[model samples]
Target: MVDGATTGLFLDAAGMKALGAAIAIAITGYASAIAEKDIGTAAIGAMAENEGLFGKGLILTVIPETIVIFGLVVALLINSA
Candidate 1:
């Protein structure tokens, strides 16, 4: 009986950790999307004003993508733990 109870508790904890990792990834992805939206808008405006600014605008637009990459790394760490 004691073993069963301990096993159940361990499963519960593991489930919680999995859920937390999923939430972290989802929230960060959403935030990155929001940031990308604004950055894309600004980049478009800048590009319209000066065609030569395309490279800079592209870099700025892609910067927010790092948030998703970091989120994936964190999720992997959480799951590993």
Candidate 2:
């Protein structure tokens, strides 16, 4: 019974770590999506007003993607640990 309890506890800890990693990735991706949505809307408006602004708008739209990259790194670190 003691061994079973110990094994269960260990598995629980591992599960928690996996959950944490998943949450980190999910939250960051969600945040990035929200940010990108707003940015995309604004970019479209800007592009409609001034065709010359397309390059700048594209860069701005892509900036939010870094959030997901950082999240991925954090997830990797959590899993590794």
Candidate 3:
């Protein structure tokens, strides 16, 4: 009952779901990389300190992970819609 011309132009729910999943993963991964970059710099700065700063350094470095968490939530919402 499906037409050939319309077949290529249309995607089933499953296809759309897959696309959403892929986009979610990609966005999260990109955000994770950015977070890592921030952490690396904080770590380097901590290394130069003579007093206690390990905990501060770690916290400052990983703070960028919030971006990834938000990205994940957005992706989930989009997929559900």
TM-scores vs. true structure, each candidate: 0.79, 0.80, 0.64
Candidate of highest lDDT: 2
State the lDDT at 25 in candidate 1: 97
Better of 1 and 2 by lDDT: 2
Tens-digit lDDT track of model 1 for 1-74: 34454354456667778887999899989989999999999999999999999999999998999998999999
Report per-prediction Cα RMSD to one decimal. Answer: 2.9, 2.8, 3.3
Clashing residue pairs, candidate 3? none
Give the local distance difference test score of model 3.
0.74
Candidate 3 lDDT, 18-53, residue by residue in tens = 687778768887988877897877687777873477
Weakest 10 consecutive residues of candidate 1 by summed lDDT: 1-10
Candidate ordering by lDDT (highest first): 2, 1, 3
lDDT of 1 at 5: 47
Q: Model 2, clash count?
A: 0
Native-referenced Cα lDDT, model 2: 0.90
Task: Give the winner by lDDT: 2 or 3.
Answer: 2
